[model samples]
Target chain A: MNRIDKKEAKHLLKQMMQIRQFEDAIMDLMARNIAEGGSHLYAGEEACAVGAMAAIRPDDYITSTHRGHGHAIAKGGSLPELMAEILGKETGVCKGKGGSLHLADVSKGNLGANGIVGGSIGIAAGAGLSIQLRGTDQIVLCFFGDGATNTGLFHESLNMAGKWKLPVVFICENNLYGMSVSVERACAIKDLTKKAVPYNMPAECCNGMDVLAVKDMVTKYAAKARTGEGPALIVCDTYRYYGHSRSDPRVYRTKEEEKSWRDRDCIITFGRKMQEQNILTEKEVTDLEKEVTAELEAAIDFAIKSPDPKPEELYKDVYFESPSS
Target chain B: MREITYRQALNEALSEEMERDQRVFLMGEDIAVYGGAYGVTLNLMQKFGEERVRDTAISEAAIIGAGLGAAITGMRPVVEIMYIDFMGICLEQIGNQVAKIRYMFGGKTTVPLVIRTEGGAGRTLGAHHSQSLESWFLHVPGLKVVMPATPADAKGLLKSAIREDNPILFIEHKMLYNVKGPVPEGEYLLPIGKAEVKRPGKDATVIAYSRMLYFALEAAKRLAEEGIEVEVIDPRTLLPLDMETISESVRKTHRAIIVEEGTKTGGTGAEIGMQIIENCFDYLDAPVLRIAGADVPMPKSAVLEKLAIPDAERIYREIKTLVS
Candidate 1:
């Protein structure tokens, strides 16, 4: 854990900033009626995404959830295409058919983000099964929310991966709440790793606010997964700074709770830590923030200039036409 | 050509496809060591090994989602959901994930997977196991629905559904598994949406599929003796209903009767009948008559089950009246 070089920390910091700024811009666009939809923002949970993503190779697959922009960016998705996809432009990754909730970049090994709560859990298991069948060392990192842990698929997928020893690392981003339903109300235990115990899979919990802690935990399980040791679950203790979606006012949460989590913000803490450690200076952190904002602005401008899909595009892609058919 | 049971024909199709392509594999509950609940996948695991022939837990949603995941990743997975009635457990996986992945991905991926499950009530298996639910998949736009009535179709259409890039819901009837029919010797594939004229006649056209096709054919034979020739058409694929062959036969005969084993309310007959009105309304014969199961849950009682489903006599009587 102490071996994380200054360059590595900076790269992780940059990725986290990119995700934070992207969500910030999406909220701005929603306020302005430009990007016309609800977006599940990944603002406070930046360390969880950045750290887990840092442990895998570029070719390794990751199945994402509704709040997936952080995963997409951390997996090295192009900003212009992602922004255009959110804006529903033809130049987007899914040709504008998949808006913010359904972004996918197969070429980058992001299987896709799903709208269904536990939709991508089994998909991750399948991807891991594919990897094992193909005799490859690749692993599939599955991201799901706390509410999805209560679904049947979560248990099924874990048992499958545990029994078959499929190469998957299931990451549960237990952000304390699932659309106003507290994790305590939904799940029997506060520690989400308890769900993994029944499947005979190794389970661990990490401080999601700390990038190094998440990276270390994911790196440990990912190594075991790559070596054909089967799947493991890592429950990250994090919090969402914003409401679940655009329409939510978050009346279920208290202002004290919000301020408490915001006080330990990943970006602020990571930046200050690096500055104190001489990895980066105060001026350097400010410059990084300025660079992220400028890049986000350009992405917005590009999305605005991109062409909307034609009306005929509605009929396309309903079914894949094969040569034999 | 040699005669084989519908079950053997399906086994041949799966075996040939697994032999032909390295990427194709099979997964379901008890399909590997147990040879499936209905025995259609017998000896496949022994032939293909446990790697290709995967036996899953009683997890319907995971099986379907895994099939979709594998298919999107360039592997051909034929996922069996055991029975069509069990489709309700994983309908979200079917309707939300498996069917919609390719379209939602905007043609960037090709999902080639088949969900093979048996339907129809002949054995008194009660309400849950014996119901025919192929019509449920027909409503999902991104899915291709197929039900093969004959052994020849069982082999050919299964091959075609495996090769087709779209996600297909291949519904087989439990009653038709033992039905024998002649099959071709070598590898052959049938078009997914072509309807075959099983027995050609001119007085009235009968559009039927799966188990209902046999009843209609028997009724046609009885009607032929009564000087009323009933043309029987088997619409093997429901999603892409072969309207070309159906409408053509309707135009020729000027009368149409739809036969299905599913209950009457929201059955396949309603859609096919409405399409007949939409397409061949000007042909001017009569309103499309449908002989379908009674609109109620399949009862465990043998007599009640017999009374609920339409039989050869009911088809004969219905077609005779329509022709008159």
Candidate 2:
């Protein structure tokens, strides 16, 4: 059964709310020119990030993609630092060096967002190798887009993770498109799970809009991987509410498709499901939204008032201090 | 003192470093059972077992990417690319991720990764197999470039590089793997950014590294016989270049010449010679000359290959011209 206690379920709802609100606020900032840098919004894909992260332990690893604010939020990243980072402030998680596309909260097991397509796949394999060699049960949840599966790194890393049986889960956030090009135009076959066939990895496709379904499907694999059953690849059939970036006009998709996806907004549906199950009251769900709003408002205030990285910090942090450099 | 081949010296360094640090490991294509392309990692798998001395698939990006991943996660990984020419295939991982991660992360993490690869043309491997790609990594800020000319330096510098907290591109010459040189027994480590005056003299200062270091020494020996004495200084560590040593030598000799096996266009010699002009310009009696390889790819013909790279005769001739 796709079940969890009311507290954990409400926790998932809160994280989803944080991601949605944060992404929406970023769009507002970009419109007003408050945040000058580019941002890949993750508004509609909240369930996939929250549900998959809900299955893993806090100490476990996660390698995120360019659109990674949702993953960081679900992985226990501080909203203040995340906001500070996106605003290019010194108090940010990466000390302001990594902006939107490179936000990393390594202290919380978030390995940062990658700017390049398919960049984090191989790194996920390496982290898995680290766990395997060190005899740890920590599994790395690697996230990438449908477009990344076509890259050579995707093939090489998957073959490696399968051959070595490194404990990892290759999560495909298949929102049906790679930027302007739909997956139908880019991929030869529409079924994305078939890409894992040659690697001999156990694969599945789940309704990414449902947090319970995503959590149930991924929890099984995460448990199996911990028991030394090797790796698995999964597809989360989700959608991004915004364009590839802030400036992308999103002329590729039809309004009907957009409305259909928004009709099943993850937060609204999941909150309704919780209410029907008697897991929480409607008043409780409203309370969570109120808490999230206060949190995001505090994060915004902290980000706006924070100072920029000093000009002389340029030469710093190139290399960490070791015995020899 | 024990005389060993450069290949043997590198193997010893790997074995000792893995023995000393449990966090240290090796990963690459054909580096385990097949014993590395140049045999530098021979017998390491037997000594460290399959887990520590990992044999990877023929995926350059994964090999390097995995190394970076392991490094930032508190493990020390020494990964290998068979040929320096092949580094171009995975330059994104090396340049963008491994090199820039520490700086990009604001020093919150350390990437203790060492990339071992071989370059230079000698066996007529053509353009694809042999290339001096050290200058490419040198251009990346977060990377350290090391080229050890002798077997002793190779063993010592590889140890230092393995212990280094940053990404290091350790370039070896395919031609120098078999060359024998004296190496201290047991364990010894040389500092990464220091230069040594191989042969001191009064006429000119020849700055070289890798195989070019030997060419400069050969030229210095012959020029010594002609009373046109030349000093040879090897800048073993390329990134934190021992410019102080080179400038001090140039101040004494009043002449500087850079010999490199890579091409003259945008080569290491150009960078080093320009630095000499900028740092020690007033001390120079004449313009600093760079004796680099011909501006062409490594060809199939041995004669053409020989004519392309710098030799002792060419170094000696270039020095004679600069001094007179």
Candidate 3:
């Protein structure tokens, strides 16, 4: 689209690097038993989250998947609060209740991430409905994996959003595999964008490794959604550099295939582009990397120093205080 | 005070709430133009317009999820699931999402929504349509399960559920829709977890709610004729069971009999019986007895369905045996 200016390119590259650095810190903490439960890192699919999320305003809503750290960061999430949540500290965004999978920063218009696959599809449509009812021009950008297209909620939400002309953008990050199962084996159709045909919505696909391509595509669709043209679909052909979760060895894919995807790493490619365009100097790039690393390290220290919830806190936040019988 | 059918009382509550608050809206399948499958929401679409009175497709999960999302965004959405049997289709949204959103979000968001559905077996609607599944929602921690036995409660409690900040599973009985009772005129809100003693007595206590409350009250009258005066207590809300009122009654009567239309096994009655033993074990004069439907699917045949569910006769017999 030739729309990537110097400022936009720098922002996208910085956001992608921040996400990568944050996930790497989480991996290190998980190794040391500092963060409990699964961490679905968004290392390889950084461009999909940063580009798509950066296209929307702070008030525009976005529903995320289990692998949602990048989306949260791009949507203006607090580094300390997110790290604290993953570390199960009382100062977390969800007050230590929701770990990695259920991170939510409502103030940033993040409806929250879901542990269940495709669980947030219908919720995104609902947020769209709310915006429409409120007579706002804001659009909802719903993020999900390729595996979500196989769920009933995918079809139901798409049809409802289409019928109602709700202002929503359904962005599918087709990272090829859902856990160990490859998309080729699970899906009958090869092109994920074709699934949007039945819903009669505008559908497109882009090189997920290119931040400019993803941002341009999402921005175009999001504009249409804001103008009340109904929901649109954009499938980002990407791959996760890490395994689906911490426990996964990724035995399903060959090492050669993994190396091929890593060579096209979104962060490196975007950084190189920024440097070649004279948008950022090598020193600037190196300084941004150090900044992200230091930010992540400080967040980790804050999380470590934060106290665990008191025993009495177990009874709070339940809302329903039924008599203990 | 004015006498109205349970359906009219519920309609009044919805109408009054919608009128009082601009944030309150209604959404469900067949609720807008059709006035709901049970006619409880009749003429609402005309009053509220299509924007506020939304008629959804036959997508139960989406309806529930949308309502939950709307509620989180500061909208009071009252969703009707048509029948309790259809709750299975959307129970994931309720159990996994709606019930846990507030707590999982660390109480940052409030899901002020009500899921209203009718459940009971009287008409021959077959095994699927006719089933009382209130016990299913009682096991969920963050949900408030409410069942109104009288028109007054049906009106006041529905208003209260709409006003509550937590998600509520408001289970209305199909048989109680036509039951007439006096509802107060204006601004009546019943507390969510309070139990009311319908008829006070001393020999035994009959713990029941919704449609079964009527059967228990009738059985209490028959038991009175036989010199066994039974106290009838209606637990309006199940999740926050009014164990205090229940235990107080059990302490006075020293005997208890629970009546419900749901199956006997794993029924809420068993939970109440256990609570009675735990709290008032020293005051008990006899083992708590439960008169519940047989542990089987509701049959379509009239005769079989009648035998499958508990009735006034069954409650009377159970109370007589417990008091003896």
Candidate 4:
């Protein structure tokens, strides 16, 4: 049974709607060529980030992936700052230095989105080590794709985390595709969650399209990690409606395949479910949509008006104390 | 002041830093109970406990990645890589991650990490265990590389590397661990990126670091008896090469010879030679020379290994050819 109440479901629906609108605005920005580089969109995976992040504390650390805008927003990151960072503006979260793939809001406990595959897994373990040593209740959430499981670092990090009993939750947003390669061709194990069994770490598989199910599962597992149970791997079987990045046409997968995953869209399914259960009215849904659209528009306007970073600032932050200084 | 071995000096630095800051900790393979592969961190786990002194699995990439993660999130991690040759397995974490994180993050984050690993060949540990591959790290930007020579330098530079808010690769020579020198009792932090003149002379400048610095000093003494004054300079920090001190020494002698234990191709000697030509080209009276190891994998036999690397005799011979 889902632990979420009627009021909590409404809140989750609003947050999910917010992420959809934000990602849609990003697509518009990419179409106009205002956002450079390969921008990984997070349209279908909204419930995974929003659900998992909502269960953790604001101070708890999280290391994201290339498709990180949703995770950052769900972790209480500023919309204007994220948009500015994507647009490479001075007022961006990282002062325009990190750009899109490297977006980070450290003050809000987002360790930044990494460009490398399987890069942030070990970092999350390290952060958990810090919390354990300091004797704090803080937990760390590491979000990665199914592709990361193939790297040696993933095994190494999990082994260390299990041995030390570090307070970290390894959440694999198994979108089933590593770029153009499908999960069937990539991983030997059909059930990706079973990969964590070798490390003696507890593992689970949750319906990622159900926001309440994801939120309930993360809440229970995150509590276990906090109470000195060590690291746990939670696999959220989700999907991305768009291509791998801005450049990918996603020709590798068929229309039937994409439509099958699209039918279970978290936002549309959850919103209708709320109305059917009388948890929320149609009037309430319309109001939330209008409010979220305006919020996203304001964020876009703020980013567009922001100034570009100066060329001289390039050499400023390479090292904390450079040799010349 | 009290005299201590290079190994003891490193142990003292780790203990003092851990005592001073609760955030400071040590994590490596066999470091806690086994006292480290080289015993550089002997008795640390007993004093600091398992929480502060962590013993990790034999995973270099995990050690480096965890250290980076701990650093950016408020803790100060000093990881041990057992041997410098093992860096080949974990260079992606150091080069692509730690070295690029802060810069790629727009300087919003700082990785205050120190990786202490021993390198250089005198021991017949073969190619996998013995190597002077500091040059590989020197090629990377945003990384501070420090190769301390004597006991004092080992103690002081390590303390500095631990306190500094940057990722530093602290390379210790394998043979220098037992060598003793004067080291201050407590609280000493040597400034990085500064060169020290071990012996002042007039005819020529001998630039070296780590174990090579000792060879340069021995050669300088032998040359002094022969009425040839050779100045020996140890550029302790390599990445931020102390070009100012090096250029000043070059102007006085008008000649320079760099001695390094690594291969002649793309060694530290090559970098020093290029800098000498670029900055002190007008002051030069003769072409710059370098005494470096032969271009080959380290051999198992002691005789062949010695022939491959530079020694006191080779330094003396190289300086004789440059000044005579």
The fnat scores of all predictions, in order, read 0.70, 0.68, 0.54, 0.68
Point out the higher-scoring one by TM-score: 3 or 4.
3
Give the top-scoring candidate (lDDT): 1
**What lDDT tens digits, residue by residue, belong to model 1 across residues B163-245?**
98989999999999999999996698999989999999999899999999999999999999989998999999999889999
Report the C-alpha lDDT of model 1 over A101-218, residue by residue, as the tens digit.
8889888899999999999998899888888888889999999999999998988889888889989999999899989999988878888888888888899999899898899999
Question: Which whole-number lDDT from 0 to 100 does residue B225 have in model 4?
Answer: 96
Q: Model 2: how far is B255 from its true place, Å?
A: 1.6
lDDT of each: 0.91, 0.90, 0.89, 0.90
- DockQ of candidate 2 relative to the true structure: 0.70
Clashes per model (N, Cα, C within 3 A) = 0, 0, 0, 0
Tens-digit lDDT track for model 2 on B1-324? 779999999999999999999999999989999899989989899988999998998999989888877887778999999999898779999888998887777778888899999999889988998778787877898888999999999999999889888788999999999999999877789988899899889889999999999888988898898999888999999997999999999999999999999989998988999999999989989999999989998887989999989899999988898898
The native-contact fraction of candidate 3 is: 0.54
Better of 1 and 2 by lDDT: 1
User: Over the full model, what C-alpha lDDT does candidate 2 score relative to the true structure?
Assistant: 0.90
Model 3 segments beyond 4 Å from truth? A320-325
Q: Give the per-residue lDDT digits (tens) of candidate 3, residues B33-121.
A: 99998898899999989989998888888888888878877688899999999999888889988899877777787778899999999
Highest DockQ scorer: 1
Q: lDDT of model 3 at residue B288?
A: 84
